[model samples]
Target: MESVSRDLDMPDDSNPLRRLSLEQLRRRTSMKWRTYPHDVLPLWVAEMDVPLAEPVAEAITDAVALGDTGYPAGTAYAEALAEFAHKWWGWGGLAVGRTAIVPDVMLGIVEMLKLVSSPGDPVIVNCPVYPPFYQFVGNLDRPVVEAPLGPDLRIEFAALENAFRSAGRGSARGAALGAARGANRPVYLLCSPHNPTGTVHTAAELTRIAHLAREYGVRVVVDEIHAPIVAAGASFVPFLSVPGAENGLSLMSASKAWNLAGLKAALAIAGPEAADDLARIPEEVSHGPSHVGVIAHTAALRDGGDWLDALLRGLDDNRRLLASLLAEHLPSIGYAPAQGTFLAWLDCRDLGLGSDPAEAFLKRGRVALSSGRAFGTGGEGFVRLNLAASPEVITEAVRRMASAVV
Candidate 1:
């Protein structure tokens, strides 16, 4: 563990994001750095290359200082999340009583899925979604159907309707009811502020999704880990906040915005009518979340807003810098600037890099990126780039990419 600088205290006006030089970042022992050789620049994981938010750091440090590391128990984390949601998204309907602590976003999503559907059921998802959506759902023995996004990177309701209808075609019976029409329901694993693409879904789109779920006997569970990272002109609509979303559940965390993924804390919130289903999760599962994670995430939600805002500003600059770099060095690679999270999805089909462009980038360019093919349908000839690095690193990466293609 390297010593974090005290300069982490929020400066009145300075780009905190770019402050870390390459040498300093390498000192980190995390998998993001240790996975690749010394020469390779690893940008495949969702981890940001910025310093931890001061409040989150202090919270963890304080807990350690007091020797408070133990099993987690309480309503503090849930209440903090409720307050943050109300203050930020104007989601006034959030009830702390309806929330449950989970180990992390993915695990929470898995648990929520179990509550709504049984094994051998059907799970619907948007294509080119987070790879874990496929992995986790399959782990539960559920069938997955894809609804690819439209050209504008927005939800395609027609595709969703087809998948929803298709997913609900089995005969009525215990677990089969989950995928059966006229009774029971299938699960729609939605990724809001969707991963890989970073497109912030609009309220109208969410409302329609909710209505579709209602009409087709489908249950909705939204992965909203990136909800708090929305940039200008884009507002995140909590799935539970939609009119017809009373049967949906949303999994969120302070991990993404505050860069606290290692903390291992997350929450699964249910809509008014669906709270009972989520409450059925066994108490034994609650023991999975770390006590330190609760302290760190609670502190982040309650006091890390200013730090998050500063991060959003820096990420905004980094997003534009990436666009400029791509335009200057690899004009043929199509990039749609992300509206929320610090991720850039590049269209590399034109580069003739075969099915997986990340392979060429890693081997020839010494830069690691997330391969698009693993993201399931509609992902061929694409790659996901992490835009959470310093401007110099981003520029150097593009330069290397250009060199590889030429």
Candidate 2:
């Protein structure tokens, strides 16, 4: 691998994404780097091209040095998250007693779905979302119903209500029992600071969703892994903090914000009213979290705040940089600045790349972007680019994409 030094456009030294050179990043054997050929500028997957936070690295190293590898134990993860949440989002209601440790965000979401809905029940998701929402829910034998987001990439309340009604038809038992029971109800899997599009759902939107869920006897399960990655103007509202959300469940992890996805640990938090439902989770599910993962995640939530802030700033810069690069190099492509998450959803319909623009980018430009079709409805003729990279790489990716178009 050839060494590539920092570009003048890179963020300041405090930005973790700028810490590693291209060669150093290529040395990583993670899915992000290894999935593509040597020449391909991979901007797919959720992995961040950044070094681990010092606190996270230290915690993991110390644990390994002490040979402290064992099954996860204690409420440390939940407690750390509570502190982080309170400090960052002004959420003071994270009851550690109502939380459970799960392997990761997606698995935690799957388990949460199982807790509220039975096999063959409908699981509703906003389309053009994380593809796993469909895969995991389908693997559990639950059918996935799509409620596509509105043109603004925000949740569509009417579409959501329609999905809720459609899903409720199959759960007559739950609807008949009313919202209080919440048994045999359809599960609405929400991606906060939504993936692909990076739309930060406002508190008002979340509260309305909670109200609708209550009215339709739909259970809301939120994937809040990107909770800590919101940009400056956007506020991340924990689904559980909103009114009428006492029956909702949320899965949070420090993985996305801290770039600790390889270390699998997440928290499944229940609303006060849903504690009984959470308690029904299989005990074996708790065994899924790695002890080291717990330690790393705890350290991240507790001690990695400054690093997270720096990363967010870097991401903000990268998102803006991408906008300029696209405007200059790929002028026909449409991209809205993301409110959160390090992903950019690009509209490639005008590029005439047909349904899957990622294929053309990969083959012609040697740039790997996430296929929009895999994200389901409203995703075709689009591509999801991972913006958690050096400014130079992002620039080069856009140049390559433009070349492919030409």
lDDT scores in order: 0.85, 0.90
Per-residue CA lDDT of model 2 for 121-170, tens digit only, reads: 88999999999998999899999999999999999989999999888743
TM-score per prediction, in order, is 0.93, 0.96
Off by over 4 Å in 2: 1-12, 169-174, 178-184
Predicted structure 1, TM vs. truth: 0.93
Task: Using lDDT, give the best candidate's number.
Answer: 2
State the lDDT of candidate 1 residue by residue for 1-406, as single tens digits.
0112333232324555776767777899988899999888888899887887788899889999999999999999989988998999999888888899889999998899888888877899898999999999999988898999988788998899988777764322332544444344589999998998998988898999988777677889999999998777778888889899987898999888877888899999989899899889989888999999999999999998898888788888888898888888898999978888889999999998999999999999999999999999889999999888766677777887887795
Q: Clashing residue pairs in candidate 2, if any?
A: none
Listed per model in order, the count of residue pairs whose N, CA or C atoms clash below 3 Å is: 0, 0
- Report the error of model 1 at residue 367, Å: 0.5
